[model samples]
Structure formats: structure tokens, C-alpha cells
Target: MNDLTKIMVSKGGTPADITVGDALEYRAALQEHHAQSAGHTLFYAWLRRLGSLPDDAPATLRNPSRATGQVGIEQLVDRCDLTCRPVRDLMVDYLTERRPGLDYPNAGQRPRSLS
Candidate 1:
């Protein structure tokens, strides 16, 4: 918490005035320094419990990197490397129609079976 306190004081704000952006910047600094402390998460939670954060503040300070979006049907089918063009198009259409109910792993498996 001393690190966060330093950040807050440097910005001319108290601990209660720390924003989500401030927390993220701190996390980035930790990453840059290859630090592996979970203190930030604890401190963020403490601030939240004291009602120091906005209602829209995230429940956790951990910002996991995830794939931006789902892969397209064409991309999924193309990965299968089906030699038959007509069969590839058919798989694409079939997967596109069924994609609403299927997850990525299941959708990916369907095209591989045809290969």
C-alpha cells in the first residue's frame, strides 16, 4: 500500500481519491518491473470496502489478457485445410448456421472431422 500511497501523494490526491486508471497504471508499472506482488489486489479491495471507489469499478483489479473476439467461421474452417473447395464451403455454411449454439472448441472440431 505504500507504493500506492506514493502514487496518490505524487498525484496530489489522497488514498480515497485513487481511480481505476490509477490502479491500472500501477499494475502496468509492476508489469514493467517484473514484480509479482498481489498487494495491489488487496489494496483495491480494501479501498472498495471503504466505499472509496465508483459503483462501476471492476470487482477485481486483475486485468487478464484474453483474445479480443471469437474467430470467424471462415477462419475456423480454413484451419482444417480441407482439399475439397465445395466441402469447405459446405462446412463453413454449416458452422455459421450452428455457431449460435456452439463454442469455439466444438465448432473447430466439426471441420476437422471432414478432413
Candidate 2:
């Protein structure tokens, strides 16, 4: 298939308005990052780092709209697919298990207490 189609598929069918060359570069970067990632913590860290970049960051860092939470959503979707788990379920489980002190409104809801 075409490069555009390949990129779209690799990103879990998310639409990316990028040239074929850029798509290839992005694919390589994603593959490299995924390969190097130790686990979910590293993945979350990378997404947070991406989200914290200044608005005027370069194309590579700015292409994903992190300031508006788009990057986080994308990362969640990607992670869910990678782990073969439901997004809400995984997040709820993570928060409940990882941060036991937080107050979760419901068993399936996210933690509401953050200090």
C-alpha cells in the first residue's frame, strides 16, 4: 500500500496531515521510541514531555497538539492498542493500583484526589 495508508494504519487509523516523507520519518521515530521504552511509565513520561513543550517548538515537537491534550489522547489510544486492553479499563486499573491513596469516585472512574 501507499506510504500515507501505512502511516495511518500504524497510528491506529488516526488521520495525519503529513507528507509521505515526513510520515516515514515519524514512523521511524515511533518505532525507535517504542523499542526503547521500558514500560508504561516511560511511555507516560514521553507523552508528558511532549505535552510540556513550548507552543513555539519546532515542527517535530509541535506537530502533535500537546497543549490542547491531543497528544495525550493519541498516546492513550496507542498504548491501549499496544497492550491490547481497553483504554478506560487500563487507565482506571492503573490509577487504582498504582496510586492507592487517591479517591476514586467509582470503581471504574479515574482518581479525583490529586495532591
Model 2 C-alpha lDDT per residue in residues 5-100, reported as the tens digit of each score: 545565554333333344436555656887531231232233335454334433343333443343433455465556555756667566556454
Candidate 1 structure, TM-score to reference: 0.52
Please estimate how well model 2 matches the true structure, expressed as its whole-model Cα lDDT.
0.45
- Candidate 2: clashing pairs of residues: none
Report the Cα lDDT for residue 86, model 1.
100
After superposition on all CA atoms, what RMSD does each candidate show versus the true structure? 9.2, 13.7
lDDT, candidate 2, at 113:
51
Score candidate 1 by lDDT.
Answer: 0.74
Candidate 1: worst 10 consecutive residues by lDDT?
106-115
Error of 2 at 106 (Å): 27
Top-scoring candidate (lDDT): 1
Q: Candidate 2: where is the Cα deviation over 4 Å? A: 1-55, 60-62, 66-70, 86-88, 91-115
lDDT of 1 by residue, 1-115 (tens): 7776767776768888888678778788887899884765787887788888888777776743222245678987898999999999999999787775554445445533432
